[model samples]
Structure formats: C-alpha cells, structure tokens
Target chain A: MRYAMVIDTLKCVGCSDCVVACQTENDVPHGYCRDWVTESVIGTYPEVEIELRSERCNHCDNTPCVRTCPTAASHVIEGGIVLVDRDLCIGCGACIESCPYDARYRHPEWGTVDKCTFCVHRVHKGQDPACVSVCPTNCMYFGDIDDANSEVSKLIAVRKYKTLAPEAGTKPQIYYLI
Target chain B: MIPFQISGSEEVFISGRNIPHIDPHLTLWEFPISLYLFLGGLSAGILFFSAVVHLINKEDEFKGAAKWAPIVVPFALSIGLLALVYDLGNPFYSWRLYTTIRLESPMSWGAWVLLIVTPLSILWVMTYIRELFPVIKYENYKMPFLYKVEELAVKYKKYMALALLPLTIILGIYTGILLSAFNARPLWNNAILGPLFLVSGLSTAAATIILFAKSHHERQWFSKIDILLIVIEIGLIIHLIMGYYAGNEMQIEALDVLMNGEFTTMFFGLLVVLGLLVPLILEVFELAGFKVPVIIPAILILIGGLIFRILMVEAGQLSRILY
Candidate 1:
C-alpha cells in the first residue's frame, strides 16, 4: 500500500508547526530540514496574495535520489518512502545534487545523507506522521493510497490535487490541493 | 522571520505568517575539495595521454614524457584521492563509495571509474617501471618472472596505448558531465563543459610534462603541445562565455555573478588573468622573437588551470537562484 501526504494550501496557516514536529521527531540537524515552508507573494500592493509551499521528499515512484546514489544507501521503501541508510551513506552529497526538489541534506553529526522518511519509524507502528498529527489547521492528510476507505484515498477522490515539478517524471506521491 | 519592505507602501499581509526566504548570502560553502578532484583527474588523464602518444611514436624528443607519464599520473591520482578523503567528514567510511553501483548517477560512475582506473593505472605503471629506470633493469637481484612481465609490456605497448587512451578520454569528460548533470543549476548545466574539461585535461597534461621533462628536446616538444592546448582552451572559454551571455535571465544572472558579484575578482583575477592570460602572453612571447625560457609560462598555466577549476565550481554553486 502506498502512503502519501495531500496538503491543502488554501487551508494552511503557514504556522511551521509541521516543520518543528518533523525536526523534533527525526532529530534532524540544525541549518538542515526534512520539511520546509516557502512563501511566494504574487502581485504588488493591495492585490498581493501569499502562496505557501511545504516541501519534502516526494517519495517518488521512480526516485532520482536512488538512481544517483552510487551506493544502494538511498532507496525507496515499500510505501515509496525514499529513505537513506545512514550506515551505508558515504555523505558524498551526490544524492543532494541529483534531487531536483533539494529535499535532502548531509547531516553534520551523523555525517550521512538524511531526508524525510515520512516518519517511517512512526508510520511502521500504525500511527500518523508527527507532521500530520501536530498540524493545527488540519492541512496535512496522510494514509495508505491502497486502502479505498483510507482518509488520503477519500481525499484524493474528492479534492483537486497537483504535484510539484510534474515534468521531473519522478511521480511524486505528495499531492497539493490548490 | 523578516518582513518584506516595500518603499512608499504600507505594510500589507493577508495571512498571520510572515513571508520568509533565504538571502543570496546563504549558499553552500565554497569547498575547495572539488577542485582537487577535477585537477587530479585532468592531470592524470593528460599524463596518460602523453604517455600513450610517446609510447607509440617513440621519438627521442618524447622519451622523457613517456617515462614520466606513468610516474606522474598515478601520483596525481593518489593526491586526488587524498584530497577527496580530506574533504570528507568521515574519511574512514569513504569505502561506502564502492558499496553500490547506480549507473544513472555521476558520482556512482565516478566512484567506480576511480576504483578501477586507479589500480589498473598503477599496475600499468608498474609493468613498465623496470624499462623506465635502468637501475631497476640491473638491480642486484631480479626474478626471471619479472623479466617475463617486462618483456610482455614491451610486446604489448600498442595494446596498452589503445586501452589507456579511451580510459583517459572517459576520465577527462566524466568530470564535466558531473557538473553538467545539475540542470537546475544553470551555471553548470552547459553542454560545453565536457569539451572544456577535455581541453583542461590536455592543458594540464602538457603542463605536467613541462614540469618534469629532463631533456631540452623533450621540454621543447611538450611546450609546443602545452601552447597548443592553451590556445584551444582559450577558444573554448570564449565560446562558453558567449553562450552564457546569450542565454536566459538565469544564465545571465549567473554570468553577472561571475563578472560583477562577490566571485568577480576571483573569476577574472585568478582564473582569467593569472591562469589563462599570463600563460598565454608568455607562450606568445616565446612564439615571437623573444628568447625567454618556457618554465615560467608552464608554471603559470599549471597554477591557472588549478584556479580555473576552483573558480568555475565555486561560481556555479554559489550563484544558484533557488525559487
């Protein structure tokens, strides 16, 4: 069963609680993040509208990070959660180079490549990711795409969703609702 | 957490969260490590090239290059490996580079290439060492088996030359491809980089030959080759710069960064002037009626080539306009 996060940008408050939750849950290094928020303002003066984008590993169906990693240290898991094996990672930064989204980072302490694992450690035990659980505005939806009754599947059926950089051909599992 | 400042306009925000973005100042550190890698690979490839050509032609003028190529290529490669290790935070775990093979990745290709070429090149050198050094030929004691191997190298020099040529071309071009793979990074995504790197390999290879050639005849012939390589390199630079100029805003911005931003001085001062210009001027002098030695120009060109790689890598990484 594939798992994915569908983020509704109109519903997002830009609170950064998800960023905090993901970092604390994963113990990610300083100056590096598995999840990040970017804000873009369109138009000038009174007509301006703010667009917020939260980015992480797309958990691509055809992951470029895996293709670019010299060692099999970076690979996609069963749910298509692209994860890095810290023990096997040489901290070469090649995966970082290969990733178009710039979702991964070389950890200062671990000295290995690290990225969003979809909180796999938590998801493996049948729980929502820290970001999904902690999100105050209910902007994040996480569930198995395989289950027709799952919340994510139901949301995908009902909502208009889009993926970032669709031209990249990676088939990102993360869906954004505009 | 900083607020956007617009002149002659009141502060306006539709949402509670402020728009925050990284300043242009925050970029990946200009790590000098890649330069070492590029230079080492170029030097090794060039030396290997010189070795192959000299081994085939076997002219008296090319003998010094033939002898030095085997010694110098491996040494430069060893130094490149050391530089890469030094750049790593965990050098001990560098072995992990060899643990996998993802053909699509340049690093993966490079890692495997290095792994195979380094040892093979070293063995290739060892196979010819006794011939290069007369002292090794008449050592106090020698094995008959070793003599048989030496006989083999002499017999198969043509085959070894053919093998080393393709390997050298691959080594030279792969570095350029590594930089070009980052398509999002427009500064480095140019197709010309492969040819640029090929010329760089030739340029540095000639520099190395000039640095070590013991005989006047060998030095003169190599200097001619070095001068030719330098000319070709200048032509490639002009072509690349023209491409950069005529491209889109991103490419133009990148060129601006190299021509007028923080990296401007280094790019023009070190890479263009010290590296390319001075060396070219010196070569021109020798080509004209001047009687100066080629040693100074060779040294300048060598230093220039090293600095050129460093500047290109740094400028490319630092000038990224991430949206």
Candidate 2:
C-alpha cells in the first residue's frame, strides 16, 4: 500500500505541536527534530502574505537516499514507508546529501542516520501517528493513498495541493494543501 | 494615511525551526571528506600514468613514471582510506560496505573499486620492491617467499598494467561522481564534475612526479603533460561555470556561491590564479628554457588540487536546491 501524508497550510497555526509530538514519540535527541514548522512571509506592507507549513520526510517513491546508500541501510518497507536499518548504516552521510528536503539527520547517539518513520509502530497497531493524534488543529491527514476511499487520498483529490521540490523527480508522498 | 510611504519592493522571508545541520548549513561532510577526495584522485592519477607508461613499454626511458610513481599509490590510498574511515560516524560498521553492491550508488562503486585497487597497487609495488630497495636482499634476509611472490608479480606485470589502466580512470572519475550523484546540491549536480575531477587528478599526479623524478628528462616530460592538462582543466572550469550561469534559478544561485559569495576570493585568487594560472605560466616558461624552479609550480598545483576539493565540498553543501 502506498501511504501518504497531506497537510493543510490554511489550517496549520505553526504551533509546532507536531514537531514536539514527533520528538517525544520517537525519542529524538534534544537538539534535533524529525519534523519542523516553517513560516514564510511574501510581499511588502499592505500586500504581505504569510504561509505556515509543518514539514517532514516525504517518503519519496524514487528515493535518492535509498539509491545512493552504499550498504542498502536505507530502504522502503511495506506501506511505502522509508526506514533506516541502523545496524547496516555506516553513517556515511551520503543519504543526507541526497535528500533535497534535509529530512534525515545523523543520530549523534546511534551514529547512524535517522528521520521520520510516520510512526509505523502505531500505524501497525491501527492507530494514527503521534503527530497526527496530537495535532490540535487536525491539519495533518495520514493514510494509504492507494485506497481510493482513504482520508489522505480523498483530501489530496479534492484540494489544490503541492509537494516540495517536485522538480527533484523524487515523487514525494507529502502533499501540502495550499 | 501616514505621510511616509511603505517600500513597494517584493520581499520573501522564510523562518524554519529546522535542526542545525539541516537549516543554517550542511555540516555533514567536513575537511576529512575533502582530503579523502583529493588523496583518492591523486592515487588514481599516479596509477593511471604509471600503467600507461608500462603498457607503452617506456619503462626503461620513463622509469620514474612506470616504476617509482606507483609505489606512492598504495601509501596515498591507505591515507585516503584512513581519512574516509575517520569521517564515518560508525567506523566499525564500515565493513558492511562490502556485503553487497548497489550498482546505482557511486559510493558503493567507489568502495568496491578501492578494495580491489588497493591490493592491486600493493602487488604492483611488490614487483618492483627489489629495484626500489637495493640494500635489502630477500635471500639474505631469509624471505624466499617474498622473492617468489615478486618473481610471479614481475611475470604478470603486463596484465596488472592492463587491469589498472581502466580501473584508475574509474577511480578518478568516481571521486567527482560521488559528489555529483547528490541532486540535492546544485553545485555538485553538474555532469561535468566527473571529467573535471579526472583531469585535475591527472594534472596533480603529473606535478607530483615532476617533484621527485631524478631524471631531468622525466621532469620535463611531466611538465609538458601538466601544461596540457592545466589548459584542459581551465576549459572545463569555464564550461562548468558557463553551464551553471545558463542554468535554472537554483543553478544560478549555486554559481553565485562560487562567483560572488563566500568562496569567490578563494575560488578566483587561490584556486584559479595561484593554483592553476601561476603554475601554468611557470611550467610554460620552464618548457621555453627559462630557469623556473620546478618545485614552485609542482607545489602550487598540489595545493590547488587539494583546495579545489575542499571548496567544492564546502560550497556545494551550501548551495542547496531548497532552503
């Protein structure tokens, strides 16, 4: 199943609750984060416009990280979720350079790369990811996009959305609804 | 309405709570990686030229290039590999690199090539050990095993040269491909990086040979080759910059990092002028019977070669496709 995440820019308040939820759920190091909140302001004075986005790993279909990994430490599993096998990872940092989103980080403790796993542990237990469950505004939608009736698929189908760095040809799974 | 007017200029500001390495700049690869690339390229170039001289049966006339030069490859490669391992976050798990070969990965290709080439270089050196070390007689030292191995190596020396010819080229090109494979970095995404690095590697190797080749004829021969390689390197640099200038917004921004940003002075002053241009003129004049101290141009080229890799790694990391 091809899983996807759809985040609505209009609904997000840039509170960064998702970032905190991800850190707590995954036990990410204190100084590092798997997801982040971005605020962009455009134009001048009266014509100014603002956009807020909560971003994370796109879990790209054509994964450059996976393609460039020498030891096959980075791979895609069931549900199109990209994960790293830390044991196999030599911590070469090649994957970090390959990622346009800058999603992955070298775990200082494990000495291997780490990134958002979409809380696959919770997904396997038939529960939403911690960030999705903790998001007060309910701006983030996560589900199998291949299933036509899935919430993520339906939201993406109806909304005017864009993915980050589409020109990168990675076919990112995260859709940002504007 | 207020008396003062608000600026009508369009402005875009982005604020992200991204982590350190991912946000302000990519500090993932550091000086170790730069040194690794430089040394790897140097080793490749030495082996390439040495193999070519051997294959052409010029070993008698160009003994420095064919024999003495290759002895440095093993040592250079060892040091480069050490730098690579030192840069790794989990050095213990580095052995996993050989468990499988991912054909699409330039890194995998490099790891495998290094594994094979390192041993091949040692074998090549072993064949010439007797000549290199005249004082140490294997029979007197009771190392008949080494003597036998050397005899076999000499017998298969031509075959080794044939094998090394293509492998060295791959290793040289692989140094640049390692960076260029990352599409995330605009400055490294260009295809010209492969050939540019290969030529730079060859030029550096020629300079290195010019430094220690005892024969005046050998020094002059390498000096002439370095001059040609330098010209080609300049041409490649021009095309690389021109390509970036004519590219999309991201590429133009990458070009700006080299031309008008933090690396501008180092790129133009150190690498272009002192590293390449100065050495080019010195070598040219030396060829015209001028008494140019060979060490000056040779040392400059070596330093320039190293600086080029450092600047590329550092500047490429800064020129991301997205902020």
Candidate 3:
C-alpha cells in the first residue's frame, strides 16, 4: 500500500507545531529537525501572497536516495515509506546530496543519515503520525493512498493539489492542497 | 479600471528553513572527497598509461611510464582509499559496500572496481619490484616463494595490462559519474562531467609521467599527449557551460554559480586560465624547443586538476534544483 500525506496550505498558520511534534516524537537533536515549516512570501509589497507549508520527506516512488546509496542502507519498505537502516549505513552522505526536498539530515549523535519515517511505529499501531496528530489547525491528513477508501486517497482525488519539484520526476507522495 | 503594471518584478522570500547544511549549502562532502577523486583519477591515468605502454611493447623505451609510474599507482590508490574511509561517517561499516551490489549506484560500481583494481595494481607493481630495487636480492633473502610470484607476474604482465585497459577507463569515468548521478544538484547533473573528468585524469597522468620520467624523449612524448588532452578538456568545459546556459531554470541558475556566483574567479581564473590554459600554452612552447622547465607546467597541471575537482564538489553542492 502507498502511504501518503496531504497538507492543506490554507489551513496552516505557520505555528511550527508539527516541527516541534516531530522532534519530540523522534528525539531529534536540538539543532536538527526531521520536519520544518516554511513561509513563502511572493510578489511585491501590496500585491504579495503568502504560503505556509509544513514540509518533510516526500518518500518518493523513485527515490534517488535509495538508488544512489552505495550500500542498501536506504530502502523503501512496505507502503512505499522510505527508511534508512542505521546499522548498514556507512554514512557516506550520498543520499543527502541526492534528495531534492532537502529532507534528510546527518544525525550528529548517531553519525548516520536520518529523516522523517512517516512515524512508522505509530502508523503500525493504528495511530496518526505525531505531526498530523499535534497539528492544531487539522491541516494534515495521512493514510494509505493505495486504498481507495482511505482519507488521503479521498482528499487527493477530490481536491486540486500540487507536489514540489514535479520536474524532478521523483513521484513524490506528499500532496499540498492550495 | 485599468492599472499600470511592471513586468517580472515579483520577489520570493522563504523563511524558517535556516538549516545549517541543507539551507545555506550542502557541505556533506568536503576536501577528503575531492582528494579521493583526484588521487583516484591520478591512479587511473597512471595505470592507463603504464598498461598501454606494456601492450604496445614500448616497455624498453618508456621504462619510466611502464615501470616507475606503475610503482606509484598502488601507493596513490591506498592513500585515496584511506581518504575515502576517513570521509565516511560510519567507516567501520564500510565493508557493507561489498555485501551486495546495486548496479544503478555509481558508488557501488566504484567500490567494486577499486576492490579488484587495488590488488591488481599491487600485483602489477610486484612484477617490477626487482627492477625498481636492485639491492634487495630475493635469491639470497631465501624468499623463493616471493620470487616465484614475481616471476609469474612478469610472465603474465601482458594479460594484466589487457585487463587494466578497460578497468582504467571505467575508473576514470566513475569518478565523474559519482558526482553527475546526483540529479538533484543542478550543477553536477550535466552529462559532460564524465568525459571531462576522464580527460582531466589522463592529462594529470601525463603531467605526472613528465615529472617522473628520466629520459627527455619519454617526457616530451607525454608532454604532447597532455597538450592534446588539455585542449579537449577546454572544449568539454565550453560545451558544459553552453549546455547549462541553454537548459531549464535550475540549470541556468547552476551555470550562474560557476559563471557569476562566488565560484566565478576560481572557476575562470584558476581552473580555466591558470590550470588548463597556461599549462597548455607552456607545454606547447616546450614542444617548440623553448627552454622551459617541464616541471612548471607539470606542477601547474597537477595543482589545476586538483582545484578543478575541489571547485566541482563545493560549487555543485551549493547549487540545488529545488532552491
């Protein structure tokens, strides 16, 4: 099953609650983050438009990180969720260079590359990812996109949305409803 | 109501990303990777020249290229491998690179190539051990086993050369492919990187031969080859820039990084002018019977080759497609 995330940009307030939730859930180092909030201000002053996005790994179907990795450290598990095997990783940082979203980071303490896993542990236990659960604006939705009945699939099918860097042809799973 | 409008005056500002490595630039790879690529290319070039000389039966006339230069390959490769290991975050798990091979991964291809080529290089050098050092007589030292292995190596030296010819080409191209495979990095996504790196490697190897060769004839022979390779390298660089300039938005921005960005002076002044052009002109004059010291151009080419790699790695990381 292809798991995916749908984020409603209009509902997001740029409060960064998802960013804090991910760090606390993953125990990420202080200076590093697995997810981040970005505020894009476009156009000149009086005619400007602002977009607030909570961004993380796209967990692409054609993941360059998995393809470029020297060892099989980076791999896509069931549900098309890209994950890193810390034990097998030589930590060469090739995957980091190949990522288009700038999603992955080298963990300072573990010395291995780390990124958002869609909170696989929580997902397996029938719960939403920390970021989705903690988002007060209820802007985020997560489910198996492969399942026609899933919320994520329904949202993507009914709404006009966009994915980052479509020209990259990575087939990113994250959808942002404009 | 009609309002006056300015064309293409919109600006975009992004905030809250401020990530150290990912935001300002990608610094995941540093000097160690550049050194490894340089030394790896140098080793490939040395092996290529030595093997070709052996295959062509010019070992007697070009003793320096065939024997002395091959002697340096193993040492250079060893140090390069050490630099690679040092660059790894989990170097202890480096053995994992060999557990399984991913054909799509250039890094996997490099690891496998090095695994085979490193030992083969040592064996190639072993064949010339006695000729390189006359003082250590293996007969008197009671190392008949060592002597026998050396004898076998010399007997099958031609076969080793045959194997090395293609492997050297692969190794040379692999250095460039490693960087170019990162499609997300706009500056490194160009296809010309492969041949550019290969020609640079050959040129650097020729310079090294010029530096090490004892005979004037051997030095001049390689000097001419280096001049040709330098010209090809310049042509490739021009094509690379032209391709980037005509590419999409990200590629155009990537070209800006080299042409007008922070790397402009280093890329143009050091790599193009001083590294490749100056050395090319000097080598040309040297061929014309001018009393130019061969070492000057040789050293300049070596330094320039190294600077080219460092700039490619650093600037390529700084130029991203998503940004």
Error of 1 at A16 (Å): 1.6
Which scores better on TM-score, 1 or 2?
2
Which pairs of residues collide in candidate 2? none
Reference A-B contact fraction recovered by candidate 3? 0.60
**Candidate 1 local Cα displacement, residue B46, angstroms:** 3.2
Model number with the top DockQ = 2
Query: What is candidate 3's lDDT per residue for B188-273, written digit by digit as tens?
Result: 98799999999999999999999888798999999989999999999999999999988987888778878998999999999999
Q: Fnat of the models, one by one? A: 0.31, 0.66, 0.60
- For model 1, the superposed segments whose C-alpha errors exceed 4 Å read A144-162, A166-171, B1-32, B127-155, B215-217, B319-322
Model 2: how far residue B209 lies from native, Å: 0.9
**Chain A (candidate 1) TM-score to true chain A:** 0.95
DockQ of 3: 0.58
Per-residue lDDT tens digits for candidate 3, residues A55-148, read 8999999999999998989999999999999999999999999998888988887788999999999999999999999999999999999899
What interface Cα RMSD is found for model 2?
A: 3.3
Per-residue alpha-carbon lDDT of candidate 2 for residues B1-323, written as tens digits (9 for 90 to 100) = 11111133221212234466556556699999999999999999999988898888888788888788778889999999999999998999999999999999999999999999999999898888778788878778788788888888899999999999899999999999999999999999999999999999999999888886869999999999999999999999999999998998889988888999899999999999999999999999999999999999999999999999999999999877753
- Report the candidate with higher DockQ, 1 versus 3: 3
Report how far off residue B300 is in candidate 3 (Å): 0.4
| lDDT (Cα atoms) of all candidates against the true structure | 0.72, 0.90, 0.89
Cα lDDT for residue A148, candidate 3: 98
